[model samples]
Target: MTSLNEIPARTESVELEPLREDKKKIFEDILRYFETNQRGYIKVPTGWGKTFLSKHIMKKYYDEGKLMLFLVSKNNPLLSQAYYNRKKNQPLFPNSALLYSERRVDRKELAATLRALGQKKGEGFVLFASLQTILGKQSAEIKDLILKFTDLAIVDEIHNFINNRGNDFLNEFGERTKILGMTATPFQGVVGNVKFVDEIAGDMREIYTKTLPECILDNELAPLKYTIAESSEDIFEIFDFEKGLGELDRQDLFLDCSTPDRLKKVIRRTQLAKDVYDSMVKQRHAKTLVFCAPVRKRVYGVGGGDKEINAFHAKLTSSIFNGDISAKKLEKDIEPVLPVDFKNYTPEGKFRDAVFISSELPKDEQNAILAAFREMGKPPYVLCTVGMLIEGFDFPGLETLILLRPTLSMRLFEQQVGRVTRLSPISGKQQGSIFEISDSIDSLYQRFGEGVFSGEKVDQVQMLQPEIRLEELFSEGDAARAIEEGKIEIKKVELGLRGKGKGVKIKEVPVKLPPTSIRAKYFSRLLALTEEKDVGAFEREKRELMRAALKFRVRELRDAEELAKLAANVNKLKREAYEDRRLGDVSRQHKPKVFGEVEWLLKLQALNSLKYEGEHLSLQEKNRILKTLGFEPDFRKIDSHRLKCLKLGSAHKTIPELVKVLGFVSRLSSSETYQFLDKKKKEQWKRELLPAVYWGFCFIEDSPELKDLFESTEWDRRVKNIIRQK
Candidate 1:
């Protein structure tokens, strides 16, 4: 059984047992996300015990025996971790399984095993399986188990397999069960990546994110000593549109970097970077993991055609690059840079051609090799991969990291650097180290290392763009143009900005370009706009003005640029409201008579001639009706009909927000006087009019009607059909 201490970073919050303040905060955030039924990701630095926090929160939330945990993964690594924690937190999950690749278990066996432990309602039970096993091998059975029993599915690393694995689950499960996605970073790549994340888990609010610098400063992660080798100018020269690739190639860049010179430059810079780190860290660069440019075989297709290309991308991201270079040549480059003793290279611990894995080694030899490469005092002091080791993999001896992967993706770059940033659990190492081969990938080290500060006093966080794919490098982000083309919008932000201090003041901050589906653009634009003075619209209609003012008052609580754009979104919303009202108005005019929620529909029903709905009442004459109803009863003073019509129209003009406002007054038709109708007819009019009057005049909770329409249901479908027609 893994002890509670090992499972979660916690303490008894008292004098005898001190609490881990950071972990406590993180755990509380997780609890809030769950309590709110939120469905998004939270980020914690690599060494901030993210796994432990997950365990801690899971224990807290699973106090209800009704909870059935579903662990979603590609492999059993998380499953094993969960198993250990479950053991440590026994009775919390008395029934749990750890099914890995080598020892596979079918869903039947899994289901039976869980049921055996607890068949009663509220009995705690869980099943753990890799997404591959559940979605691929035991897909049908797992689906049955999920549909029949599972309540909440806790997915690990959604950013990884969400497009496919997540799609499979969502398609089968629908929205019948709830989902929780856990990851170190919330956002992934720019276009396709965010789309997938949004598809599976993006709808969920971003509960919390603990920045890397915070973790490092707090000693949860080691402080990184980052160094850049090649100047940005030299690095930029490789992708030089003027030198390496012509403007034509730049116009349409391929997945594989087309320019041979550029690829060679990447390789050379990578080698140089390795040599620098090896000299600095005292190794053959074996312990240093290098994140390289993603090596894909071909173009990435959205609908799944190029298999090998996809596999290469996945494999590169997984960090098992196996290739070698000339040892003699490698030594020649580094020998001049450092003294002879700068690196430790022996026959037994020599820098191998292929660093991460070599199938040539026997099982025991391979195990020992892995141990040495990962451990502090072992041979083969460096290792390398692409985006693979950014998260999940834990190794304390990985003291230094060399950045060979020239990337523009800020999130990817941060994640890669985060590899070595963790405070090694075993070594108690105080600092992590990073060597940049080239900082040309948009000044990777400078911006990340020294975060941009706005004011000396104001403490506010401005959002930054996380993903900058290589594709974006080829073209200018013309988001403003897109906005003009109606591809983007300056949405009115509903910031419940509360509390006050002369928050962040934006002075001379260059306004960021409009968001091109990139957070940087939105964040930048917002920061500038938030500092603006002009806030409200004076030209709006009464209802519009009232709502917009309410929205503005709420916004003033915080200092943000989004408030500046509030009127634009408000205007758009006002247009929509007007259109809905117009639809109802038009439907009334075209109708033959009046009566219901639509004033026009009600008017059609109400304006009937001799229209009492019954055998005896239907036969009543209009003169008799007028006399009995006491409506212009004398008939000679009957310019009274015009007077009654005027009165009804004026009454319906109030409460524009209430959709059926006119329906109540439309019932008071001059043509259909009520006095002559039989008792049954009067009763019928009262029966229907009472509800119609209630809908238009009364302020009921279901006034808007849209709130009651939960999409795809019959009522919602009907409302949408009416909206479309209108």
Candidate 2:
């Protein structure tokens, strides 16, 4: 709870430059509009000093004895960007304080600061708040504090709040306060289920806008050299169902990084970016900035692609650039051994681990890396980021931007492209280079609009045709080679399971089956049998053989020759299962006729064993098992010994008397029970024991056991109907 009172005042001084004539006019026009309007938004390009203009205007209101609130979303570097700007431009608001989640205000200190500022005329206090922090779980008190003290609110990156959560916070400040929202892209086109432009218009009026073209024309920003390379469909189709993915909702698939199939696409796209960077621009360095596709986890996982055939995975490539030599061991063996104190010791011209930054990183660590990246001839000469560096962040030395992910949001695309557009005289940067890796350049041109990056030169946007197509680099044999070389970790993916072809590449399987489909499940099991170690398959086969032998015994089949024949047939089926050969041929030829209505009881036992281990049984399996076991499978409470004794003509005695005479055989240990009964009776009971105790016992109407069985059956039926949508 570091409050304003605990924080030190800014003592350093900064020389200020007079705003350019065009920028000065735009700034004054925004002030003039705010004088008449209560609420409005300003749209301007990224490098146009939007933060300075807004803060300058807020200071005017602050001088008029008004309390101002500067707001941005949580995890937004803008909050910190504004904080640093405040330190540089101390004359803007002398009594300003930060109110983000990381550095919260003490309630008492905040009240005192506001109270003192409130007492004096022409004195104001600005609370720079993070919307994500103020509107979270413990937001009631903080929201009340903001509403009580704030007179005017200036929201930055306003496009982020075009949702119910944002509206609810906005609605809290009714007519008592005036609002002004600012963003480079005022309307974000269409996002998810709604039209974002209409939503923004309903909330605030768009008073001003400055496009990239206008900014470039005014010489306010650097000219950009754009290049596009379409990723090969053949490389993508190397993974199953990727070709058919065109028919599916691509936007939804893109967001879902949970599945290995989708993640493989992202990895291949990233690998293409790496190749393009290596061939086109790695030597020049020139402070490259890379934007990668979103991943669920930033660290270790199975990433599919081949370099023995052609591509470097996302994690491995990042580790190489980041100078994190240790991470490479997950994919392959480490090459040269490094000094123990490597991270802190940057020997001579050796690069360091500042090459990668993402939203998943801690704020302080991200800030330190960003600071390093901003400097010219730095360790992170080539920097990679997920999405954190796209908006608000300023880096004049960014001369190269590589986009590895495609976006449907025009605003986001513009923001990503704008990162490298800032002019840097010290670095002698006249133009920025943008290398885009995607499947279609025509679709990009159509989606982002034509001539979006038009410059004074005729060849502003260049299309670089790859000499060796991505598809040409891949072969069906490369996947197995990469796995053998330990470059690709083989994941136990539950896809493409049913095919019987041994050593079949996953890319060749083109059928698209839902993850939960019965066919997909069978395929996964089949894949495990063929691709994985034989231990699991052997255990499963042994269990099946033992269960079959028990079934023959239960059926009163005493022929040793028939038993031997059944064991041999089971062994053949097991061998075929491991060999990826069809089981039907062998089964039909030597299969036993032991499968009957009573055999369903043995199936129940097998299915129940799976349940006992907490494995998920499919709908068909669940129904079959439930139908055989009488639903509720608990048997510990059933008086099996008492029932057996009563059936053997001991019904005249009470339950207690029977327990005293028969000694509760189920509760007694095996050796103790055998001592109580003769050898013949003991063997007979042992053979028929468990099933007789569990289901062979009789139950009358209104009994608790009977009620539980009925309830469990009804519940199973209800669940099955719901799951099947019956």
lDDT of 2 by residue, 1-726 (tens): 675665444333223446768767977887787676667788777887888777666766766767788898754467766755544544345567777667666856765666655555365667788887777665556577677667788888888776557656876775657778888765443221123322533446777877665565566777655555555533233222232323122211122233444444444445555545555564454788777654333212333332120112233346545535432232342223222222322566444633566545577876777777777776667677655667776887888887665554445666887788788887888677787664532222233232212210001111111111111111112322332333322121111223564321222111111111222222223223322323321322222222222221111112222333333433454454444434354443322221221223233323333344223345454344333333333333223432442343222233344333222333332343445777877544433332222222222121454334322322222121111110
Evaluated against the true structure, the overall lDDT of model 2 is 0.47
Q: Write the per-residue lDDT of candidate 1 for residues 185-303, one digit (tens) a residue.
A: 44444211132244453355556766554555445667555454543334343433332222111111122423344433434444454344434554443356655444333322222
lDDT, residue 161, model 2? 71
Q: Which stretches of candidate 1 lie over 4 Å from their true place?
A: 1-22, 25-29, 36-40, 61-63, 85-94, 115-119, 161-163, 167-178, 191-193, 196-203, 231-267, 282-286, 294-354, 358-369, 439-726
Query: Each model's TM-score?
Result: 0.48, 0.51
RMSD versus native structure for model 1: 21.2
**How many steric overlaps are in each model, in order?**
26, 4
In candidate 2, which residue pairs get closer than 3 Å at backbone N, Cα or C atoms, i.e. clash? Answer: 306-310, 306-311, 497-523, 498-523
